[model samples]
Target: MIDSHAHIYLEHFEEDVEEVVERAIANGVEKILLPNIDSTSIEQMLRLEEQYPDVCYPMMGLHPCSVKEDFEKELQIVEDWFNKRSFLAVGEMGTDLYWDKTFWEQQKEAFHFQCELALKHDLPIVIHCRETIDETILLVEQYEGKGLKGVFHCFTGTVDQARQITNLGFFLGLGGVSTFKNGGMDKVIPHLERSKIMLETDSPYLTPAPHRGKRNEPSYISLVADKVAEFLNLSRKELDDLTTANTNKLFFPSK
Candidate 1:
């Protein structure tokens, strides 16, 4: 199985991060893809990636919530990192109106800039759309002919929204929210195509049910897979193969 988006590298897991990886591997999570939050998170993310070169992978970008008045400077740092090394994608980037909307314009501008980077690097993007799904979709729509592709990470949107994203060649990432009785992903997952979906824990955050109130870790990916499989009516192994293939295609495109 693949954790398409996770931030276990953060301070939340600093105490027993090694054990966290061990538990995840023991539970069949073969890879954990780490997304950068901002300039401060890069080192921690890269450090974890180095420790588990094969198990943990790193992606570079400025998170939407982190966008501020001087977003241009933050973007410059993101672009500089891209020049310094390779990243699976140019994300954890997108618009978020759920929090402060003070830098709404800057968030959109930064998203566009990262989209341009994805087009230039021929890489995918891992998006974080909280309350701005349509707005984010519209921004991505502008790159329609530019070969932009990636996943709408932690997707808990409507079926229509899912169709819109998939139609554009992007993927939907399902997480713990789906397991919530009222999460409503039940309406979206079953109607979707298998190839255009992936599973994620969004760990240290959206911990799956039965463990909902506790700290989330990669080891619980199976709980998410179980819920997703129940929606698709597939076995655990079947779902794993499907999402893992999708993850590999995006992060390890050369394969």
Candidate 2:
């Protein structure tokens, strides 16, 4: 299985980072993609990738919430980082009105800029949409045929939304939220064709049931897979195979 998105480089795993990764591997997680938050996190994320070259792949971009008055400078730094090395994608970028709408216009500008970067580099993206799906979809539609490939990380949208996104050639990223008892994802999952879905943990954040409220780790990705399996009425192995295939197609297409 692949944890299509996570932030294991965050300080939350400072003490047990290795163990957390080992536990994930032991539980069948084969790869993890770490999306960058901003200029501040680039070093930590790159260091993690260096330490676990095969297991951790890094993405470059300024996160929605991180957009501020100096967002252009931050984006320049991100672009510099990309020019210095190869990155799997140009994201963890999108619109987020949930926290502070004061920077909505700036966030939109930043998201579009990063989307352009993805097109220029010909890499897939890892979008972070929070309470801005309508605008997110609108911006995504603008890039339609530019080879704008990506996954809507931590997807919590409706069935119609899911269909619209998939129709645009993007995949839905299912994470720990899917395991929440009352999460609307259960209904949303059935509406999606498994081929259009990918598994993720968004770790050190959305920990699954029986472990909610605790610091999430990649190891808990198994719990997510189990829930998806139950929802799809398939065995865990079957679900893993399908989702893993979807992830590989998106991130490691040649494989």
Candidate 3:
């Protein structure tokens, strides 16, 4: 299994990062993808990647919420990292109206810039759309046939929206939210084909039910897998195999 998105590099895991990775591996989470939030997060994120190497892959991008007045400077820093080394993708990037709209225009521009970066680098993007799904989808549609491919990380949209996204050659990333009683994913997941789906934790956030409200960790991705399998009427192993295959093909295609 792969925890397609996690911020284990944050201070939340400062005291026990080792144990968290151990628990994830023990629970069969073969990889954990770390998405860069901004300039400040890059060092710690890269440190964790250097420590875990193949087990933890790092992606480069400026998160929407982090898009500020001087976002161009931040983007320059992000581009510098790309020149420095290869990343699994160019994301954790997208628009987020849920938090603050002060940087809305900047966020949209940054999202478009990063999308172009992904295409330029020939890497899949890991998108974070919060309360701006339709707007994000609209922007993405403009680049449909331009070879844009990425995942809608932490997707919580309707079946129709799912179809729109997958039809654009994108994938929906399911995580702890799928296990929530009123999260609406129960109605969404079953109607969609598993091939267009992938598993993630978005850890240190969106912890699954039975463990909701607690600080999420990668080890708990199994609970997410179990819940998704239950909704899709498939065994846990089958769900794991299917989602794992989807993730591997997206992030590690040659493998």
Q: Candidate 3: minimum summed lDDT over ten consecutive residues — where?
A: 192-201
Every model's Cα RMSD, please?
0.7, 0.8, 0.7
Off by over 4 Å in 1: none
lDDT for predicted candidate 3 compared with the true structure: 0.92
Candidate 2 lands at a TM-score of 0.98
lDDT of each: 0.92, 0.90, 0.92
Query: RMSD (Cα, Å) of candidate 2?
Result: 0.8
What TM-score, computed on C-alpha atoms, does each candidate reach? 0.98, 0.98, 0.99
Worst 10 residues of 2 by lDDT: 184-193
lDDT of 2 at 38: 92
In terms of TM-score, how similar is model 1 to the real structure? Answer: 0.98
Better of 2 and 3 by lDDT: 3
Give residue 177's lDDT in candidate 3 (0 to 100).
Answer: 92
**Model 1 worst lDDT run, 10 consecutive residues:** 246-255
Give a tens-digit lDDT track for model 3, residues 93-163: 99999889898888989998998889889999888999999999999999978998999999999999999
lDDT for 169 in candidate 1 is 92
